[model samples]
Target chain A: MLENKDLLGIKNLSPFEILSIIHTAEKMKLRINNKKLRENTLENYNMVTLFYENSTRTKMSFTMAGKYTGARVTDLGVATSSVNKGESLVDTGVTLDQMGFDIMVIRHSMTGTANLLARNVNASVINAGDGINEHPTQALLDLFTIYEKKKNFKDLKVAIIGDIAHSRVARSNIFGLKKLGAEVVVCGPATLIDKNIECLGAKVTTDLKEALKDADVVMGLRIQLERQKGGLFPDLREYSQIFGVNKDLMKYAKEDAILLHPGPVNRGVELSTDIIDGEQSLINEQVKNGVAVRMAIIDLLIERRKKDEVTNTKWSASESFIQDRWEKRYTG
Target chain B: MAAAKGGFTTICCMPNTNPVVDNEILVEYIKMKAEREAVVNVLPIGSITKGQKGEELSNIGLMAQAGICAISEDGKSVENAGLLKKAMKYASMFNLPVFSHCEDMSLVGGGVMNAGEMAQRIGMKGISADSEEVIVARDIILARSTGVKLHICHISTEGSVQLIREAKLRGEKVTAEVCPHHFSLTDEAVEGYDANTKMNPPLRAKKDVESIKKALKDNIIEIIATDHAPHHIDEKNCEYDKAAFGIVGLETALALGITHLVEEDIISPLELIEKMSTNPAKLLGIDKGSLEVGKVADITIVDPNEEYLIDANSFVSKSKNTPFNGHKVKGKVKYTIVAGKIVVDNGELMD
Candidate 1:
C-alpha cells in the first residue's frame, strides 16, 4: 500500500512504494487491453484536471485513465476559466474541494504548484507536471515501460541525455531510477545542465559517449527550442550535433539497450529520426503505459483516503459510545 | 508597535509603499502620522524616482528639506543609468545617501530563487548571482562618479560582498547592509517549496552565507537592516513563483543575529550591536544609537541569554508571513525606550 495520499514526486517515494506502483501499473496495463477484466476501482470518484499550462498528451492520458476506472473526470480549462478574472490557484482548489472533489491532478508553469495546492486542499493531489519540478506520473509510466522490457531494476545502467537542467522528466527519472538501484547518468551541455546535480545521486557528465557507455536504458529529453532566446545554446543545429542522440551514439551503449523519451519529440534534435522510430524505441509504449500508471496512482491514493476515513469514523464512534455510558451512569 | 516589539526604538520605512513616497508632502505626511500615532520613530526614505517608475527623478531636494533622511529606489534598481546618475548627483547635493536596491531586471528573468543546485533540483528558474553583482558593480561605479553616499541594501551574494569590500578599500563612500535572513538561511531552505522562504535576491548558497558572516565580522559590510516586507497571507500562500518575495524580519532580526552570529562566534555581541544599531544610525546621519551623555535615550535593552522560539502568530505585526517561525534563538528584548518612554516592555508593546 502507498503511504502517501498524494503522489507529488518520486523523490519522496520509498523503494517499496516505487515497486508497488510499478506492479499495480502492470495489472492496470492488462486491464486496459482486456475490457471485460476492467474493474470500477475508482467508481463515482470525482477527479478534476487543473492544468495551468497547455498540454495534450499528459492531460488526455489522465482523463482517459480516470474514465477507464469509472471516475468522472473534469478538465478545468484555465484559458476560459475564472483564473483570468483573478481567482487564485488556492481559491480554485478550495472551491473544487468544497464541491467534493476526490482528486486534483494539477500542472502549472511554476515549480511546486502541486505541493502548494496539496497543502491547502483535502483532495488527494497528483502532480501531473510542475515547472522544472517532478512529473511523477510521467516517471512512473517510464518505469512501467522499462520494467516491461527489463525484468528487474537492479544494477541497470540508465543514461539520460539532453536538457537535464530544465527537464522535469530527467529530474523525476533520476530520483525514481536511483531508488530502484539503477546507475543513472545525466548528460547535457554545460549551459543546459545544472550545477551540482550529482547531489541528487546521478553521475553528471557533458560527454554523451561517456554517459551511454554500456547503458541498459538510454533516455532522451526534448530540447526546448525556446531556451535559445535565453542563449542557453547558440542554435538547435549546434545542439543537435553535439548532444543529440543518433545511431552513432547508440553504439556506445549495449547491443540490447532500449530507448525512452517523454514525447512530443523534436525529431533530429534530441534524437535522430531513425532512433525515434527504431525497434529499440519504447516511446510509443511509454504513452500507452502513461494511462495505466496514472490509473494505478489514482486508485492507490483513493484507497488510502478510504482507509483514513474508516479509521477516523471508528475512533469517533467509540468516543460517542463511551460518552453515552458515562452520561447514563452519572444520571442513574 | 511592531518595530517597538522587535526591540527597535526607530525604524526607517522603505519608499516602496502604495502611492510611492516621492514628494515633500508625503514625507511630511509620514512624519506627522508617525508623531501622532506611532509608538516608535518612523523615518521615511523618499523614492529616487517620481512614482518609483524609474523614468525621472523625484523631488529629492524638496523632500530632503521636508525631513526625509535618505533617498532610495528600494524594491528595484533604477533601470535607466543616466537618470540614476542624475538622481545620485541630486541626492549627493542634498547629503542624502542613496539606498540602492541593486538588481539588473534583465538578468532576473522571472527567477524565483537563487540560480543554484536547489533551484535546479526542484525545477524552478534561478536568479543568478550576476543579477545582483552586476548592479552592485554598476551602482558602486555610479556612486564613485557622482560622489553620492551609496548604501547597498540587503547584500546577499559573495561576489557583491567582494565588490563592496574592494570599494571600501578604495575609500569610495560606499557602505552595505546584510539582512538577517541572508546570513541565517541558504537556497536549501527553498527545498520544501514553502512560500515563506521566498525573498528578493533569494537565499544564496552556503558559501554566500559564510562570506556574509565573514563580511560582517571584518567590517566589510557595515550595517544590518531588515528588508522587512510584509505581505497578506493570501499573497504568500500560493505557488512558489506566484508568491510575493520577502519575509517579515523586524521581529526576528535581533534574535537571528544573536543566535547565528553572536552565539556561533562569527561576531561579538558589541560588534552585532554596532552592525545592527550604530552603523545604520551613522549612515542615516541620525543623532541616536548611543547611550552617551546628552544623547537621546533611544535604547533597546535585551537579555542576551534568554532562549525561545520565534512564533509569527505572536507578532505585533498584522502579517505573519515570516519564514523564521519556530526558529529557536537566544536574546529577548526586555525594554525598548524611544526618547526615554517605554514602548516595548517584556517583549510586548505598551500603550
Candidate 2:
C-alpha cells in the first residue's frame, strides 16, 4: 500500500492527484462502457467500509465500485456493531485497520471524524462525508464526470447553483474545479449560498440569470434538509422559487452544457425533474462513474498496498511517470 | 401616487430558543416561519454544539442560514477543551459570533445559588462567581487560541465585563451581553425565596449590577438578552432547594430594558433600542437588528414610551413564572414581523 495514503475529502487533494484519479477513472469508464472489462481487476485485494451514518448513494457507489474492482469487499455495517455500543470512533478505525483492510472508505456524521479515523487506521482512508465537512471522492467523480465529457477543466465557467451553505460537495468542487483552473460561479439565495466561497476564487452571485449566462456547466447542489437541526430555511418552497434551477434559468447556459447534481436530487425544489432527466443532464453518468472513480481510488490505494508487485507488473510509460511521482511522494 | 403610513414594527424575542439553532436549518426555519406567519424577520441563534449537548460540531458552511445567523450554548458552557478549539477553528467557516452562558458546571459543582454574601445570609449555599468567571477565562483563551468569535452571555459581574472590554481592545472577536435583571436586580431580589429569580449562574451583588450598568453605558456589554427561558409552573413553584432555575423573559425583556437601562438615565433611548434590537443581531451575525432593504423583511415595531406592568400569566410563550411579575416598565413590541407577515400585532397572535 502507498504509505501515509489518506483521502480526507477531495478538498485536501491538489490538481495533479485529482487528474490522476480522473485519468484512472476514465480508463475504467472506457472499459466498462465498451463491455470489454469483466476482470474484477482487484480480485485478491480487500476493502473495508465503515459507515457511521445514513447514506443512499455513497454506500451503494462504494460497494459496487469495490466489487467491480475484483476486491473482496467486506462491509462493516455499523448499525449493529460495537461502534453503536458506545465504542469510540477511534477504536473502530483501529479495529478495521488492524484487521488488515487495504483501504478504508468511511462516512461519519461528525466533523473531523474521518481525519481522526485516518490517524488510527493502518489502511488508506477515503472520507465519504464527515458531517457537512467534505466529501473528497464525490468531488473527484464529479470532476471526473465533467472532465471526461469536456476533456479539460481549464477556463471552464461552471455555476454551482443551490445549497452551497450545507454542501460539502460544493466546497470540494470549488477546490477541485478551481485548482484545475475553472472559474466557478456559486449561485443561490443569500441564505442558501455561502458567500465566503468567493475567497476560494469563485464568484458569488444571487442572480440566476447572471450566474448561468455562458456557463459551461450548471451544477446544482441538493438542499440538505435531513441535516437541518431546526430549520435554517424560511421555506423550501420559497427557496425553490428564488434559487432553484429551472428551464428558464437553464436557457441562459451554454447550449451544449450540462446539469450536474451530486444526486439524490430534490426534484423541482433544487432542479426541475424534466431537466434532471434531459439529455443535457450528466447526473446519471455521475452516478455510473461514481463506482468507476471509487474503483480507481481503491485500485490506486491497493497498488500502493503491494510492495514489489508493480515491479514485475508492466505498466504504460505515462503510468511509469505516475509511479515516479508516487515514489517521490513517499521518499520525500 | 403612493400610499403612506408612517409607522414601524418591533419584536422582543430571544435568539436562543429550543432546537438550539446552530446551523442553517434552524435559521431558515425561523425566516420561513416568520415570513409566512410573523410580520418581520425571525433571527435565531444556532446552538454552539449541534444539539446543545456541547459535544458535536454544527455545520459552519456559512451563517447564511436564514433566521440563525449566530450561535450560542444557551445555558451551558463548552467543557471539552479540544471540542472548544474545534469550535473556534471552524469559527470562520460559518462566520458566526458564538455566545456562551459562561458557567463552568465542573467548577461550580451545580451550586444553585450565586457564591456571595446573600447566599451566606440566607444560609443557603451559593456558587462562586469564580465558577462563571473561570469559564469566561477559558472561553476567552479558547477564542484567542483559535481566533473564533466569542461573546459572553449575561455578564453579571465586573470582572467579566472588564475582561471582554480588554479583549475587544486587543482586537479579539470578543463581545458581551447583560440581562434585564442583571442590572435591574441583585441577589437581594432572591430574598423572598422566589424560585423564579433562581437561575443557573444565579443573580449577583449590587456592585456587580453597577458594573453591568456601567458596561452597558460603556458599550462593553453590547446586547441585553432576556435569557427568555420558559418553563411550566410545576417546574418552578417548589422550594428553592427543589425548584428549577430560570424565569421566562420574552414578553418582559424590552420593557425591562426600557425601564432599567433607558428610563433610569443609565443609557440613551436609541442606544437601548440598538442594544435590544440591533447589537444582538450583529452579535449573532444577522441582518434582523436593522432596517436594510433587500433584507429579509424582519422588522420589529415597538412603543418605547408605553408604560405597562409585567404579568406572568399573559406571555406569548407557555411559561408563567417570572421575576418581573408586577414590575412597571416601558417599551412593548407593537408588532413582530418575521418576514412581512405579522406573527404578533397589537399584542395579538396573527397566526
Candidate 3:
C-alpha cells in the first residue's frame, strides 16, 4: 500500500515510492494484457485533465482507462477552450481545485510550474508535461512496458537513442530503466545528448552504433522541434546524420530485442520508417499501457489517500477500489 | 587585540555565499554572526542581485540601510550587461562600490589552475592569464560608462597588472588586489598538483608573478587580499583534479605576506598595513579597519619576525582546505583585536 500523493516528478517520490508505483503499474499492465479482471480494484474515482497545452494521445488513452475503471473525467483541450493566451496557469490550477476537482492533470510551458502548483493547490497535481522538465506518467508507462515485454529486468539492455538533449523521455527512461535493473546506455551526438548525465551515474556516448550493439531494448528519443527557439539543437538535418538510429543501426540489437519510442516519431530523422513500423517495435503497447498505469496512479493517490494506505494493515484492494463503482456508461 | 576600540587593523569581507543575501533575513544572519563571533564591526557586502544568481537586481535602498560595506557579485562576475549598468546606477544612489569576481566562467570554464608552461607540465586545465585581463578591460570600460567603482579581485597576470596600471594612469576609479601566491609562488608550485597551489584566477607564469610583484611594489596595485577561501580537509586530500581549490587563508595570509613581500623587499611592513587595512577600508567605505582614535579598535597584532612552518591544524576556520599546509613561512598573527575584544591573543583565540 502506497500513500496517495500526486506524483508530478521524480523529486516528489522517495526511492521506495517510485519502486512501489512501478510495481503497481506492472500488476495493472499484466492483468490488462492477460484480460483477467482480478477485481475492478479502482472504483468511483475522478481524475481531471486541466491541460493548458494540447495533448491528444495522453488525454485519449488516460480517458479510456478512467472509463474502464469507473471514474469521471473532465478534459479541457485547446480547440474547445480559451486558456492558451490569456489565463495564467497558477490561476487555472486554483480554479480547478476550487471546483471540487479530485486530482488535476496539468501541462504547462514553465519548468517546475507543476511542482509549484502542487504546493498551492489542494488537489493532487499530476504534471502532464512541463517544458523540458519531466513527465512522470510517461516514465511510469515506459517502465511498465519494459517490465511486461522483457519480463526480467536484470536480463535487459535498454538503449535510449535520438535527441538525447531535448528529449525529457530519455531523461525519464534513464531513471526508470536504471532503477529496474536494466543496463541502460544513452547514445547520440554531443549536441543532442546531456553532457552531465555521468553525474547522474549513467554512461553517455556519441557513437550511436556502438551503444545499440547488444541492446535488449532500443528506445528512440524525439526531437522536440519547438526547442529550436530554446536553442537545444543547432539544426535538425545535421542532428539526424551524426546520431539518428535508422534501420541499419537497428540490426545491431539482440535477435529478440524490441524497439521503443514515446512517439510523434520523426520518421527518418531518429528512427527509420521500417523500424518504427517493424516487428520489433513495441511503440503501440507503450501508449496502451500508459492508461492502465495512470489509472493505477490516480486510484492510489485520490481514492486511497483518504483510506490511509500506508498505515493500513493490508491494502484491502476493496476499501479504496475505483474500478467496481466506475460508471458503466462512461466505458460504453 | 584591543579591549573595545584600540589598535591597527587590516582586511575586509566580500559576501558571496550559498544562498546569497539580498533581504533582511539574509543580511541579519551575517549581522548576527558578526555581532556574536566577530569582535570588529561587521559590515555585510550586499549582493547586487538578490540571491546573486545574476538574474534579478536587489533593492539597494534596503541594502544600504543594512550597514553593507559595498555591493558586489563577489565570487562571480556580473555576467549580464544591461543589469550591471542598472546595478551601477542603484549602487550609485547609496554610494556603494561594486566589487566583482571578474572571471568570465565561460572563458575560464575548464580552468583548473593558472595556465602557463607549468600547467602544460602538470596536465591540468588552466585559466589563461588573458581570461582575467579581457574581463578586467571590459569592466574598466563599463566602469567608465556607468562610473561604478570597479574593483578587481585576486589580480594574477602581467596583462591584467599592466591594464589596471594603464587604467589608473587614465584616472579610472579602478583598484586591484594581488594575492601572496600570485607574487610569491609561480606556476611551478602547481607542478606537483599541491591543491593549495590551486586558486581561481589560478596562479601565474614566473614573469607574470614578477609583474604582479612590481605592481604591488610600485603601488600600481592598491591591495594584497588573501582571497581567504576556506574548505574542509575532505575537499583537498586527493588528486589535483579531484581536490577542491582555495587555501584556508584568513589565519595564514599575513604570514605569507610577511614572508613574500617584507623579506623580499617588494613591500615594507607599514605599506602592507596601509594596503591591507587602511586602503581597503577606505575603498569599501568601512570605518573599522584602522588604528585611529574613535575608530572601532579592530586591530591585528603581529610578530613580524617569527618564523614557522605553515600548519593548518591550528586554524580557526571550520574548513581545513588550505593550500599553504606545509610551506615554511615567517611572521604570525600574535593577536587579533576586534573592536575592543581580544578575539585572538598570543596566537590563541580568546572567547
DockQ top scorer? 1
lDDT string, candidate 3, A217-300, tens digits: 888887777655546567778777876777787788888888888887888888878888889989988888897788777767
lDDT of 1 by residue, A233-298 (tens): 999999999889999889999999999999999999999999999989999999999999998998
Best of the two (2, 3) by TM-score? 3
lDDT of candidates 1 onward, in order: 0.89, 0.72, 0.70
Let me know the DockQ for model 2: 0.00
Once superposed on the true structure, which residue ranges of model 3 sit more than 4 Å away at CA? Answer: A11-43, A76-94, A226-234, A309-332, B1-149, B152-280, B284-291, B294-351
Candidate 1 lDDT by residue in tens digits, B2-88: 888889888999899999999999999999999999999999999999999999889999999999999999989999999999999
Full candidate order by lDDT, most accurate first: 1, 2, 3
- Best TM-score goes to which candidate? 1
Worst 10 residues of 1 chain A by lDDT: A315-324
The collision pairs in model 1 are A132-B123
Which candidate has the highest lDDT of all?
Answer: 1
Per-residue lDDT of model 3, residues B86-144, tens digit only: 89877877788877677887777456777554543323456777777777888888888
> Would candidate 1 be rated incorrect, acceptable, medium or high by CAPRI criteria?
acceptable
